[model samples]
Target: MTDKNPDKGFVALLGWSLNAIEAVDRFDRRYVVVAPPWAEDYCRQNDIPFVPWDFDRLNERSHELALTLEDMGVDVAIPIFEETVEWAGAVNAVLLKNPRLLGQAMLFRDKSLMKRRAQLGGIRVGVFEEAHDRGDVIRFLKRVNQTLLKLDGDPNDPIHFKAFDKSGTAGHRVIRTPEDVDNIPDEEFPALLESHLDGWEFAVEAWIKNGKIEFLNISEYVTLGYSVFVPATPELEAHRERITEEIEKLIEVFDIDFGFIHPEYFLTSDNKLYFGEVAYRPPGFNALELIERAYGFNGYQGLVLAFDPKTTQEELDAFFPKEVVDAKGHAGCFGVYPRRRVVSRLQVPEETANHPYFEFHELSDPREQKVAKRSAFGTHWGLAYFFGDNAHDLRDLLKRQEELDYYV
Candidate 1:
C-alpha cells in the first residue's frame, strides 16, 4: 500500500473500476475499495486495499458496510457506478452522520422522483409519467401525441420509455405507436415514460465543492447514442454561464452539498433550457478519459478530489483547468456496433485509421457472427477515440464514423 497523509481524508470507493483504482492509487489520499467478493483475487494480486461487499439491494445489512468502514476510520465513500450510487448514499449518511444523503442518492437513481423534485424546485423539465404496464405505456403515448393535436393521418410524436433505475440508455426506447409499445417486455414495465423534447440535448459534468461549483464541462452528443465530444462547440459553450446557474439550482433542489453531478439538459431553439435527468456517478462514453485528453487532468482523480471532504479549496483551484480555454484540443469517441447483422471480422477502414485525428481504438475480431438487434443505444463492440484542435471538426468526425463500416 502507498503511504498516505494522515491529514487527508481516507476514502472508500463503492465499486470496482480499474480506472478509478488507478487514479486513487496514484493520488495522495489513502483509499480502500468496497466491491463484490469476486474482486478479492485481483485486489490481492495488485496489493489494493479492499473490502468484499456485494451491492445487492439496500437492506438491513446495508449498515454493515458503514459500520465496517467506520471502524476502519474511513472519512467518506465515493460511488463509481450506477449500482453503487445508492450504496454510497446509504453508507455516507452513516459515515457523514447525515441521514438525508440516502434520500438524495435515491433521487439520483429514480428518474420519475428526480424530475418531480426538479419541478418542485421550479426547474423546467419535459412532460413525464411513470408506466406500470403495456396499457399504461400505450395510454401515455396516445395522450402525449393527442396533446399535440395531431390529425388522424399525421404520424404520432415519439415518446421515450426507460427503466427508472437503469443507467443511461440501458433500457431506453423510443415509442411512436401502439405497436412499438408491444415489443416491450412485461418485465420492463414500471418504467418512466417521457414526452420527447424538441431541442439540442447535451450533458454537463460539474464537480461541486461546499455547495458551490468548482469546474463544469459540457459534453456535446453528436448523435444521441453513437458519439459524443467534449468542450462542446462554441454555440453550446456560449451557454456556460447559464449552465452553471442551473447546476447551482440543482445543488439546492437535490440538497447536494458536495461531490459531482452529471446532469443532462435540453436547449430548445427558442433558447429555453429543460432538465432531462441527473446522475451522481461518472458518465458513460469514457467522458473522464476525454476530459483527461483534452484538459490534461485525470478525471477519476478529480472524482476522488470531489468526494474527499478533507480536500482544500487551494487544491481544487489548482487541480482543474479553465473551461474551454485550457483544453489542449477537443476530444471525442464513437461507439462502434456492427452495421451488418452477421459479421465475421473487424476492420478499421483506411480513411478512419489514417485520419490525423485518429488516436486509437478499442476493438477486437468479431466475437460472434450474429449481432443482436440493437435495443435502446444498443451494445457497442467498442469505441474509436480521436483528438483534434477544432470542436466542429471533432463533432463532425465523430458523427461521420457512424456510417462507415467497422465489421464485415
Candidate 2:
C-alpha cells in the first residue's frame, strides 16, 4: 500500500470496486473499503483496508455506521454504487454535520422525486408519473399518447417504465403497445413512467467541488445500452456551451457540493435540452476506464479529489486536462450480447477485429446451450474496446457491430 499523507482527509469508500480501491490504494488519502461480509476474505488476502458492513436498505442500525467512522477519525464518506448513495448520504449527514445532505441523497436515488424536483427547478423534462401496477402503466401509455394528439388507428407513442432506484437501463423498458405492458414482470412495479422525448439522448459526467462544476465530459451514445464513446461527436460537442449551462443549472438545483455525478440529457432536433435523471455514483459500462484511456488521468483519483473537502483549486486545475483539446483520440466500446437465442460459442467477427481502431475484447464462451430472451435492454456478455481519431468513424463502427452476430 502507498503511504497516506497524514495531513489530508481519511475516506471511507461505501462499496467494492477494485478499480476504485486500487486508485485510492495508490493515492495520498487514508481509506477503508466498507462492503458486505462476502468481501472480507478477499480484502484480507489482498491487504486492502476494509470494514465489512452489510449495506442493505437503511435500518435502525444505519446510524451506528456514522458513529463508527467518526470514532475511526474518518473525515468523509464516498459512495461507489447506486445502492450506496443513500448510505453515503446518511453517513455524511452525520460526518459533515449537515442533516440536509441525507435528504439531498434521496433526490438522487429516487427517480420520480428527482424528476419532480428538476421540474420545480425549471429544468425541462418529459411528462412523467409513478406507476403502481400494470393497470397504471396501461393508463399512462394511453394518456401520454392522448396528450400527443394521437388519432384513431395511429400507433401509440412509446412511454418508458423504470424502477425508482435502479441504475442505468436495468429496469428500463419501452412500452409502445398494451401488449408490451403485459410482458412486464410483477415485481418491477411501483416504477417511474416517462413520455418518450424524441431526439438525441446522451449522458454528461461532471465533477463538482464547492458547488461548481470543475470538469465536464459529454458521452455520446450510439445506442442507449449497446455502445458509448467519450468526448462526443462534433454534432453533440456543438452543444457544449449550452450543455455546460444546463449542468450549472443542475448543480444549483441539486445543491450538490462535491463528488461526481453522471446525469443524462436529451437534445431535441430543434436544439432544446431536457434533463434525464442523474446518478450519484460512477456509470456502468466502464466509462471511467474509457475516460482514462482517452484523457490519460485516473478518474477514481479525481473522484477522491472531488470528495475530499480539503482539495485545492490548484490541484483541481492540474488534475483535469482540457476536455476535448487534450484527448489523444476517441475511445469507444461495444457491449456484446448474443443475438441468437441458442448459442454455444464466442466468435469475433473478422470485420470488427481487422479494423485499425479495434483494440481488445473480454468476450467468453457460452456457459449454457440456451440464451435467455432479453428482457429490456439486457446486460452485455462482455465489452469490446476500440480507439481511433475520428468520432464519426467510431460512431459508425459501433453502430455496425449491432448487425453482426458475435455468438453462434
Candidate 3:
C-alpha cells in the first residue's frame, strides 16, 4: 500500500470512517486522520496516522489545528462527514492560503444560503423559505397550497421541512396538514421550508479538479432515504449530458475549483432539472461503497485526487473508469427498518436470501422490544446490499426488501 511516488499530496481527512481510512491506507497518497479524541485508541491500535481534535464550532482557537496540520506538511483537508465540512474548508483555507474558501464552505452548510446562491446562479429550485418557528412553517405551508389553487375539499400538497445544517434526511419532515406542524418541536425551528417538487429524485456524485468535472455518476433513488443504486438505469442515464451541464453550472455557482460534491436534483415530468441542495462531502446510505461495488475503484481515493493540488491530469484520467460503460454490473443497497410494531430478532427473508443477486446484509438483532416512534425519515437499523447484471432486477430486488421484515 506504500506509494513509490513521493510527490503525491499529503491529505488530512477531517472525520473518522473505517471504510475511508482503509481505502486511503491502500492508496498512494500520504494521509492522516483528524478526528475526535474517541478515535485515538482505535487509530493507535490500528497503526493509523492520527490527530485528535473535536470539531466543535470554529472559533479564534480554530487556527491552532490549522497550524498543527500545516506544520505536518498536509497539503489538503477532506471532510468525510457533514459536521466537518466547515472545518475542512477552514483548515484548507489556511493550508492553501485562500481565505475565501471558508465563506464558500458556509454556503454548503446552510440550506437557505445554498438555495439562494443557486437561485442567484440561475439554477431552478422549488419555492423555499426559512422558518423561525412553528408559525412560520404553517404560514409557508398555507401560502404554497394557496398558490397551487386547491379547493376547500381538495387534499393539500405537502411542504418539506429540513434542518438548515444537517445532512440527508436528518431533521427532515413532510408537513401535509396543519396538524402535522404541531408535531414539530420548538427546538426544530429555524429550519428551511420548501414546496415539494414532484418528480424523479436522484443524486449526483461529481469529482472536480481545476474547475472541471473529473468524474460524475448519477445515483437513482428507488425510495428516498431507503434505497439507492449507482450507474443509474438507461432511462435516467439518458439525462447524463444535461446532468453534467448542471453540475458544471454548480461548480461555477459555488466557485469550486476542486473537491467532491454530492448534490440532489429532481427531474420533473417536463424534463427540466431543479436543484435540491448539495453536500460538500461523501454521501450517506453507503453511497460511496455502492459506487465502489458498481465500478472498480475506490471513491475515497478519487476524492483524494480531486482535493490534492498536486494531482496531475494523467493521474485523474487514469483513476476513473468510463462511467456506466465500464461498470461491471449494477450495485444497490436497501436500508432496513423493522416493519413490525414489536420485533424480537433479525431475519433475512428467505426469498431475499435465496435471490441470485443477493450479496450480504449488515442487519443485527433488535436491542429493544418496542420500536421507537419514527420521526421524519427515521434512521435505518442496517443495510442490505445487492449486485447483479440487470439494473431492473437490482431495482426490483431493492424495492421488494421494504415489504419483508428484517426484524421479527
Candidate 4:
C-alpha cells in the first residue's frame, strides 16, 4: 500500500466508471481524475488522489485536465472510458506541444476520423458516413443506396436505428416500413444508418504500443435470438487473424503508439469479413476484465505502461491470469420493464443475486413509469451477466434465471 507520488508517476483516467479500470486502486500510480466532482467521494474512499474538471467543452476540459495534472506533478495520463473522447485530442495536443508528457488519445473519438485514418493504412473498413441530422441521414442513405436508416423510414425495412448521443440501449428504434415514419416526431435526432450484417458479430480486443498491435482477446456474439457473449471458436480464428492484421496496419498508419481499442467485426456464412464499428476505448460490457483473463495481460496496466515504453510485458502479465477457460465465459442478456404504463414490480429467483458473473443488474426508472422504452431492436431494461462452461450453458443459465419475466 505504498503511496503513488505525483512527482514519481501517476495516470489520469477520464469518464470515470466504477468497474472498468483501476482508476482508484491503491496500487495504481498516483491517479488523477478528470471527471465530475461528485466522484470525489469515491476517490477519497479508495485513497486515490484526483483532480476534478468540467465537461462543458472538449478543448477547455482537456487543457484543464493537463493543468491540473501538471500542478499535481503527474507525467502521464490514460483515459479509462469514452466520455473523455470529447477532449482527448485537445489534451494530446497540449502534451505533444510540451516535450515530456507521454501518450496520445486523438484516434479514440470521432468515428469518421478514425476510419479515414484506418483506410489510409490499408485496413479494410465498411463504407460509413457521419450523420448529424435528418438531412445528413437522407443524403448518406441516397449515397449508399443501402441506408440502415434510423429516422423517418418505412417500418417494413427491418432496419434498426439509434442516435449518436444515446448509449446503453437508449435512443434506439426500428423502422419496419414507410408507415413507421409517422410514429416519429419531426424533431431532429443525431443518428447513423449503415447496412446491417446478418452474421456472427465479434469484438476484437487489442493493445497497441509503439505501433505494434497485440491481440488481447476475442468474443463471439450471438445477436440472433439474443446477444450472447462467448469465447471465439475455431471457425472465427481466421477472421480474427485477418482482422488483427488489418488493425495492426491501421495502428502503423495512425501511429496509435499507446492505447486499447475494441474493433467489432462481422463474419458471414462464407467467412467474408465485414467491419461493423470500432471504439477507441474498452468494450462496454465489462469485457475488459474478460480480456485480462484470456490474455494474461492487465489491459489497464498495459494502458499505463503504454506511456512508459520501458515497462515490460512480463509486468503486465503478472497482473492477469495466465490462462482463461472457454467454459469460464459469460453470457449477457437484457430485458425491458413491463410494457404497461404503470408500476412494474416483478420478482424473480433470488439466486440471481449470487450468480458468479452477474456483472450488472439494475432497473431503469427514468420516467418513474414501470414501462420501459419500447423498441424491437434495442434493449429495454434489466441486464444479467453470467458465466458458463460453454455458450449454450451460459444461455441456459440466463433462461433459467427467470428473473427477466415482464409484469405490468
The most accurate candidate by lDDT is 3
Listed in order, each prediction's TM-score against the native is: 0.98, 0.98, 0.98, 0.76
Quantify all predictions' global Cα lDDT against the true fold: 0.91, 0.92, 0.93, 0.55
**For model 2, how does the per-residue alpha-carbon lDDT over 300-400 read when each residue is reduced to its tens digit?**
88898999887899999999999999999999999999999999899899999899999999899999979999999889999999999999999999999
User: What are the runs in model 1 whose C-alpha is more than 4 Å off?
Assistant: none
At residue 239, give the lDDT of candidate 4.
61
Off by over 4 Å in 2: none
lDDT by residue (tens digit), candidate 1, 1-408: 456788999999999999889988988899999999999999999899999998985456779889999999999999999989999998999999999999999999999999999999999998999999999998888888889999898999999998999987889999988888889988897999999988999999999889988889999988888888998999999999998999999999998888989999999989999999999999988999999999999988888888898999999999988999989999999999888989999989889999999999999998789999987767778999999999898888888898899998
Q: Model 4: which ten-residue window has the lowest total lDDT?
A: 98-107
- Against the true structure, candidate 2 has what lDDT? 0.92
**Model 1, CA-based lDDT:** 0.91
Record all residue pairs in model 4 with backbone atoms less than 3 Å apart, i.e. clashing.
154-177, 154-178, 155-176, 155-177, 155-178, 156-176, 156-177, 157-176, 327-389
Candidate 2 vs 4: which has more TM-score: 2
lDDT tens readout by residue for model 4, 269-293: 7767766556666666556655544
Report RMSD (Å) for each prediction in the order shown: 1.0, 1.0, 1.0, 5.0
Tens digits of per-residue lDDT for model 3, 155-205: 999999999999999999999998999999898889999999999999999
Q: Which candidate, 3 or 4, has the higher lDDT?
A: 3
